[model samples]
Target: MSYGDHGRPVFSSDPFGTVPPGGGFFTPGPPPGYPPQPPPQSGSVNLFATLSVIFAFICAPAGAVLGHLALSRIKRTGERGRTRALVGITVSYLIIVLAVVALLVWLLRPTHTSASVGSSGRSPTSSSTPVDAALLDGTELTRVLNQPFETNAGSSQRGGVYGLREFGTSDERTEKCVGVLHPAASVTYRDSSMRTFAYQQWSRPTGDYAGAVISVDEAVVAFANPEDAQKLLARATEEWKQCNSQRVLASWGTDGKFDSWTIRDVDTTDSIVTATVGYTDAGSGTIRMPTSRALALKGNNVVDVGVVMFRDPTKSADPETSGIDVARAILDKIA
Candidate 1:
């Protein structure tokens, strides 16, 4: 279209019926306030999101991992399938909770039956004589130590097993708890009085000598086998003779005064090495206190039976016999 007064023609500015501010146009370009269109992206589906939903049912952990990756890709490269990733994550969490609950139920399940109790309130599994490691318990220990404690020279009531969780009860707790095989290292522990024979020992042994006190009065150390036991027994017996006539300075308390202790020969058997250590006061030149120490090597085991006698030093009674009795009791139980 055109309009004129002096042959000046005005051309139509509209593309169709509307004209943009730029005016002169026949074909329409992009609309106002709208950016130019970008090239079309591939219409292919996101493989990660597809795999995430599929794996969520088969393997929850794999599904959760894939879902996380899918979400990251959607943010960076503008992929689709946000819904699929979310569904996988939700299902994975539910599966995890269900698995944990199943484990708890399996672990805390109750026993359906009870064992028979005898007249002594002991189980039918109890053994009366020659108790093995499987039969070592409070009742068995009580039977072993029930006799008089000869170390005192006067009859003292032999108490129940030492250091058992409950002192006076009867159970097969040790039979199940303690390992039958020997421990690999020295096993020294402090008593309620905060005292130990760790300092009194001449040399540290290859095996532990203290943990057995949990089941018996004697401190027993286990050897690898009977041959090792015999070798230790022979060496210890030889040392007893040399150590008997010598005076060694031994200090254990916080007083910082070491006593000139003399080891007196008591007795030595084919299986035992026993002696008494007498402490002499430097100021008075008299015997103050004496402590008896005993060691017996049985098959695959070494027993330590010690007695501390501070009230008397000149008592005619043989303190060695007490130690012997203790050693014998230990062997009887473990035999």
Candidate 2:
């Protein structure tokens, strides 16, 4: 047979030899071996997973180390995650440091205004002289007692002095009965003339014998005695009326739970009388009497006066005694 173009016969067949060009067809194959295709790539690591890592690392120094590890893993695996974790760690540490510094500053702050005493013995904060309890004596007591009873009869300015004393059980229950004094000015209805030198006394019974007295310008004008005590209400009333009327000041008996009397037309020379009469009834027609008074100085411009008295409820009454003497004595000091 004639060969077409190759040395081998064009139509000849050889199992181990190359086939003729137009012989039954077979295609060329790939190179001997190719690495198996990599398994289909999983999608990039989840973004939420990176955020979770950030949260876990926040405020924790170890969080940064963990975040870095995560990032390295992601890079090797071609995954995307862990970037936020690194940022969280740094921010958390910064916040912690700032908070510590703020707390320290607040704790170290101080409060209070500075003050000092001067060489004159006066504090920069105050200059008032403190009251000396030791200085309170009989004269001072009398002056204090008379202060509240002094009254300015018809003057524009009214002033008075008063005094108080504690008596009886000394318990707080009887404390309200403690002595007190009040003095007021007087007025004449016709002339509208004002007068000073009016005074009053308040006394409450705490024990058995109890009463109060009032005086003006060193004179006893009003008094009250407890029922069943030695003193009589009628007598006391008469005495007050006589005293006030003599001064040309009106006085009368008050029909009320507390005995009250008022005087008018008071002047510097004329005494104004006001008083609270207290009474306690002891059985068997006996009565207790305690009296207090207010007085005004005629020559002195100072006019305010007052007095208060307290008595023990449990005590016995001395019928022979009247608070008139005590009242007169108190008023005498003012005169």
Which candidate tops lDDT? Answer: 1
The TM-score that candidate 1 achieves is 0.36
The regions of model 1 sitting more than 4 angstroms off are: 1-217, 253-256, 311-317
Clashes of each: 0, 70
Decoy 2 TM-score against native:
0.21
Among these predictions, the greatest TM-score belongs to 1
For residues 1-335, write the lDDT of model 2, one tens digit per residue. Answer: 43766676554345556664777755665567865443343577635446545555354445545566665665556555545645655654666577699888766533111222223333222112211111123344345343222232432221222221113222343222222112232211112212222223232223323223232222112211111111222232334444431212112223322322223222222332333323334343222233333332212222233332434434422211222333334434432
What lDDT score belongs to each candidate, Candidate 1 first? 0.48, 0.33
lDDT of 1 at 320: 56
